[model samples]
Target: MHGYVHKRLASTAAKLAVAPSAAKAFPPPDAIHNPRTFEPDTYAALQPPPASSLSALAHRLGLGLILSPTEVQQACTHSSFVSFYQKHYPKEPKPASNANLASLGNSLLGLFASEYVGASYPYMPTNIMKAVVSGYVGSKTCAAIASEIGAAPLLRWHRTPPTPLSPAPLLLHDALSSISRSIIALVYQHRSLPVTRQFVHDLFLSREVDTRAMFKFRDPKKALKLLVDKFNRERPISRLLSETGRFSNSPVFVVGIYTGADQLGEGFGTSLKMAEFRAAEDALLRVFLTRTPPEQLSLPSSTFSPTQSELYKPRKRPEPEYIPGEIGMEEMLYASSGKSGYLNPTPSLRD
Candidate 1:
């Protein structure tokens, strides 16, 4: 048996020596599966296009110049594409996907949104503030923004092992939102926070919010009562401010809400009841929609610097403290139901 094995090995060596092409064509069993053994030409042919090819997409997104076009490509690539590539080339290293980039982008978006909202509307109530931020960066809104910027067609997806049963990959709302966020993350990584802030502002925050339409009161009358009670004010009295063509086909009535001599808000409507409701709505808007100029608002990112020293600190400038409910106090006097009004001499009706 040993003699036979030696003879077979000698014969194989003689055949390999005689046919050098056989040696090159048939590698060892172990090396056959090795990814490094694959030719660079083969890999290059199978690989996706480089980042520079996506210049049109970058321009469409208003990203004039990009340092890392590869990163941008990865940001546009969905997990499905990576899965398809891995299925075909299990031995090769899996390409990067946008999942992690999307997560990072989400956090950065939240930070910028909070800063913008907080700075612009310092006195906005917590609930309304939350709603405003949600309205700005919510998945639906982000998806819409992405669609408007022509990102849907640029998104990359692959359905591997093309089969009749395989469902076609679609650009979903969440996926679009993730892509949008990943793009923001890419901007932040390659650029500075200020640039990212400006990008976010121009893309998302620049749009105006319909404050009145966003207000969803379960019971405006009850909410107003609670608001008045909390402020220790008199029960709001709806007074007729003006009326034109009272009995005509198209009559207009204006109503003003008063707490003693203070006129909180006024509204015009087709009917007396609608005018009163509009007046209440107007009052709510005044209490909630207090605004500050965008330029005047300060952001937490303003303090960040790549090379600023900790020891060489400047003296802290006194910033005006903003209490959450300070706006209401400035606009309307708060009176205690138990005692006399603190800011005003007039006693509340409950007292």
Candidate 2:
């Protein structure tokens, strides 16, 4: 009885939250789902980086946006270096320096891109939605891109997390709003606008493609430099982050893996195409852009696993015309049948 009452109260709370009339019905949302899974603290500190820095960023042509100092600092500090920091100086105070701020600003801007994409395109399926967001959140991706522009000084920070009022991290925390502002500004100047959702989606998608394929072409910022140049002579998405001035080929991060549901892996493919497709597909499902079929996929959402999907009962068969309910087939075929609807006037199966 206690359990039953508790369940009723929980159901009532859920119903009240969503308004039962609005949604038909829904199970609880998965707590651990979403692309930005790492603790915000992972990027919280812009502690001073070691001299073994990736500061010599190769510049690519046609990246119109001016590279910010903070952006560069954030890109320089990679996970490997962070580990080194933890191993060596775990208890040192945060760096109170301009260089560190610039580095963190880069990361802040990169994450801002995803949030912008999400707010901009609500129709992109959840998978693509998550992919775009997560790609930007990627530490390697940020470092690679920032390395391009020589922004890999990996800024040091002695300050607290930026509050809501100050755009210390990003001048415009809202991505779509920035785009909207851009559109408005363009319209005001040119007296025309080509602000289509499809165009924006494609633009962002191209950026994402280049970002995921960063390790391929050497320079983080200029990975797609050649490709973008062929089309429009632009530096490409990779170069936008790598502002300092160097480009070199490196191994691709997401390549040739067989991760499913909660599982993750690392492998290599002989060719770039092979590696990228394999990685992207794995990433798509891993990021919950597409849901795994319940039977085979051991999703991370399960706190208790080795459990089956919710069971559903088989549909009851319809009654025949002669019987009040389903009369046994054996009785119907044989002459020694009991009183079914045919032998009785009361409550016919047909009724």
Task: Write one digit per residue (lDDT tens) for candidate 1, span 240-282.
Answer: 9899998899999999988878887898899999898888877
> Candidate 2: lDDT of 307?
22
Worst 10-residue lDDT window for candidate 2 reads 327-336
TM-score of each: 0.66, 0.22
Task: Please identify model 2 stretches exceeding 4 Å from their true place.
Answer: 1-111, 151-206, 210-351
User: Can you write out model 2's per-residue Cα lDDT over 1-351, one digit (the tens) per residue?
Assistant: 344433543465343232223322221222123323322222223223332232222123122243332333343333223444454457964322223333443344444455454434432333445555656544344434433433322332222346688645432122112222222222222221122222233333236443233222122112122222223332311101111212334534334322222223222344455445444333322322222232432211122222223448543443222211111111111111122223322233213
Instruction: Spell out the clash pairs found in candidate 1.
Output: none
Clashes (N, CA, C under 3 Å) per candidate: 0, 35
Give the top-scoring candidate (lDDT): 1
TM-score of 1: 0.66
- Top model number, TM-score: 1
Q: How many backbone clashes does candidate 1 have?
A: 0
